[model samples]
Target: MWVLTSQFSRNLTSHSSLLSYLPDVKVGKTTDTGKFWDPHFDIHFCYKPNMKWSVLFVLGVLSWGNTLATMVPKEATFYQLDCPKEGTLQYFMLKRSGQAMMVDNTYKVMEQNITIHSNGSIIFHSLKVEFEGTHLCVMNHPDNSIHGHEVKLRVRPLPPTDLWGAVYESMFVTGLIAALVIAFIFALGCFVYKKQWRPRPEDEKPVMSGYENPAMNPSDDGESGSTNM
Candidate 1:
């Protein structure tokens, strides 16, 4: 078992936003092929309005092994992640407080190779993730202790396979090109409409329907009639 913990302070001159400071903690464990040494972690966190003694004690109890702690109004949760490779296991977590409370849309981007084994395994490298939601935990949370939702743990490293590039190319770049093509088609249609709409001798302009006005109507007076006669 390996564990790491940290703490920091943030200025609280005004409550313009949910004032919060957090200690990031990391934990790791390994297991054998037997029944239960499987790699997993169970963590607990307590949130206080300020650095209060009671709050720290509460946080400590939850971390130690008190199952009852799980019943507390928890804003952060512990999760178990799989470690396929014995190398560096990079991990991250997000905890929401004050303004974020829910998850809506979440996305993850990986720039390099990622491989998956037949056993439902996953690997990723150079990964970027974006999540949006009401009461989202990472950037926007809505609770006083933490915003709303929380990422208790995240472990990252290079993608495990080589197929990652193809996946991203299909989803992002290909989609963008498709959208542009559609817009171009619409522009062409507008141009055709303008070209066909200009006043034409066929459809829009008035027609000279009454015998071309005779070019010069014969006077009703007898003078013209007599000359022609």
Candidate 2:
């Protein structure tokens, strides 16, 4: 694999150099068999010509993988990016080379919300959800060599809120809970006090009507009845 890679590298360099001089060599000409053809000569006679497309495919895959890796947080040196809540102010600094500083490189971002400074810094006055995407910062030199960096801005949507909004929401919920707890405690205390200390009804006392009572009259009545008999 290494041998093939080295050979392909040399061939690619040679092909690039040849393209400058040979105008007739069409770079993207392909055969009916879906194989890439060499413009200078017959592809079958060329060295490992059948493997060109495969090698190109491998290089493309590697490049794509590198791009994805760079987009991740740990490897974001290639770009300036921020994930801020929507409508918040945000700032970003672009990485620049000394060579870029020495040359007259024009710097600009495409978004209207972004302000590009002379010192390779940018600011977002208020971030928006629509700003979440890859943005380009182009630096064009006097020699017409265009250098560009991608800025990946991600705008997080604001969290949902009720009528209280976010700042007062926690306090409102806490106060409501406290009030409910206090009410429950008061009701429980009243119930316990009623059960433990409240007075109960006493048993009714007997009425004292003297001789007309049943016990008092019973003996006298029986005795009188015997005497009469």
Q: Considering every candidate listed, which one attains the maximal TM-score?
A: 2
Worst 10 residues of 2 by lDDT: 96-105
- TM-scores, one per candidate: 0.20, 0.23
- As a whole number from 0 to 100, the lDDT of residue 222 in candidate 1 is 36
| Model 1 per-residue lDDT tens digits across residues 1-229 | 2232223243333533523321232324333422222122233232324547778898888777565543332212222223233222222222233321122222232233333222212333232232121211222222323222223223233343657886987789889999999999999999898888455567775767686564356666634423352
Which portions of model 2 show Cα errors greater than 4 Å?
1-113, 141-144, 163-229
Where is model 1 poorest over a 10-residue stretch in terms of lDDT? Answer: 131-140
List model 2 lDDT by residue over 1-229, tens digit each: 1211222334744576754644455545656655555545533222344577898999999999998855543211223333222222222333332122221233333343345444445555455554566654555455655556555665555555564586597888899999999999999999998789644456546667785565435464356322332
- The residue ranges of model 1 lying beyond 4 angstroms of the native Cα positions read 1-53, 61-155, 158-186, 191-216, 219-229
The candidate that wins on lDDT is: 2
